[model samples]
Target: MLRRYQTAICDALASVDGGSFCEDMWTRGRSGGGGCSRVLQDSTVLEKGGVNVSAVHGTLPPDAVTKMTCHGHHDLPAADGEGLQFYAAGLSMVIHPRNPMAPTVHLNYRFFQIFRRAPSERSGTNECGGEEATEGESLLWWFGGGADLSPSYVFEEDCVFFHEKLREQCDRCDPLYYARFKRWCDAYFRNHHRNEGRGIGGIFFDDLNENMTVSPEKFFAFAEDGLQTFIDA
Candidate 1:
């Protein structure tokens, strides 16, 4: 899904301005997986824009695992010197248009999974994520992210159209998702110094899991629909 979106979004964004996005393929820390970043700078329609996708896996620092406070933490390394094995992949994009009339938009969709390394691996007795993971070990996993819009100047029509389209999609998954995630977006993207909302909220969520009464397949479908609708908007 992320791979598909990466190409589609970059192509659509650059096609309008006749500018090209530079593809930067890179590897993560050490042996971690790699990803691609597509960026466009100084275009006719956009000031700066980027669409990045990555899948990284490594032994997470033990301290970092504790902060997450997620389920099945005891199974993962915490105070021990060795860290837990983890993997994450996602597509994230941001667009800043040349004209203030064009709203700034951002979208991100991601999945994260963490699992325990063998005891020997934790003690440095065995290398972390050393082919042991592929044998079939998965502790916990979930999907998260959202999209938002910001406009220097308010346009009631655009806001209405954007939110309405989002609401329609959210309703397809759950009747309450729109209002619920809308409030989340508003709170998440506030101008703390100014004491105001950043812009009309769209949808924002983190740590959305099956416990939220939706399946993994449903959330991925929802994210795909959101991205598709965004290009149309």
Candidate 2:
């Protein structure tokens, strides 16, 4: 799904800019998995941009688990004894248009899963190099993502249009999503020193899981629609 989004975004950008993206493939050693990075720079319509996708799995250190717990992922598998196994995949992109009037846009959508390591796997004896869980059972999983615009100069109409488009997408999934995520975007992007947001807010959400009122599948659909909305906007 992430790769699909990557392709769609790159194609859309290329079509608009009449430029092609250079692709770089990379692999994660010993841990597992790999990804492709597609970038376009100095294009006719875009100054620079990249659409990347990656899937990786490995063991999480205890400290990392602690931080996640503190950040509201209290259900993550305990990493105290043996580090918890983890899998993560995502699509991220940022676009900087050649025209300064165009906003610099950023979007990211990701899925994360945590699993308990089997005793035999904990000793670093797994055939898959300790990256794969023997039971293949996920203890917890979640979806997170957001899209926002940052313009060099604020245009009230542009900001309003961007936000309205995002709200429309969010409303398709859940009426409450727009209100909740808009507040989150505003709060998350606030600059403490300046006492204001870095830019006009769009929408942001994180840690969406089965525990929420919506199902994971619904969130996935929301992400898909959100990506399309970004392309249109």
Best by TM-score: 2
lDDT of 2 by residue, 1-233 (tens): 77777888899889999999999877677546567899999989999999988877777888888898899887765676667777777889989999988889989988888877732342232221224324356677888889998898889989889989998998898899999998998999999998988667678888887584555788788888988898787
Cα distance off (Å), candidate 2, residue 86: 0.8
Task: Determine the C-alpha RMSD for candidate 2 after optimal superposition of all C-alphas.
Answer: 4.2
Q: Could you say which candidate leads in lDDT? A: 2
Residue pairs in candidate 1 whose N, alpha carbon or C atoms collide under 3 angstroms: none
Please give the CA lDDT of all the candidate structures.
0.76, 0.81
Give per-residue CA lDDT, model 1, range 1-233, as digits (tens).
Answer: 66677888888887897999998877665456677888999989999999998876676676787876664434444535776777777889999999999889988888788767632322211122212224126666777788888999989999999899889888988889999999999999888999998777789987777563655788778878877877777
> Candidate 2, which segments miss by more than 4 Å at Cα?
118-135, 210-214
lDDT for 124 in candidate 1 is 18
Candidate 1 regions with alpha-carbon error over 4 angstroms: 70-80, 118-136, 212-214
Candidate 2 weakest lDDT stretch, 10 residues = 122-131
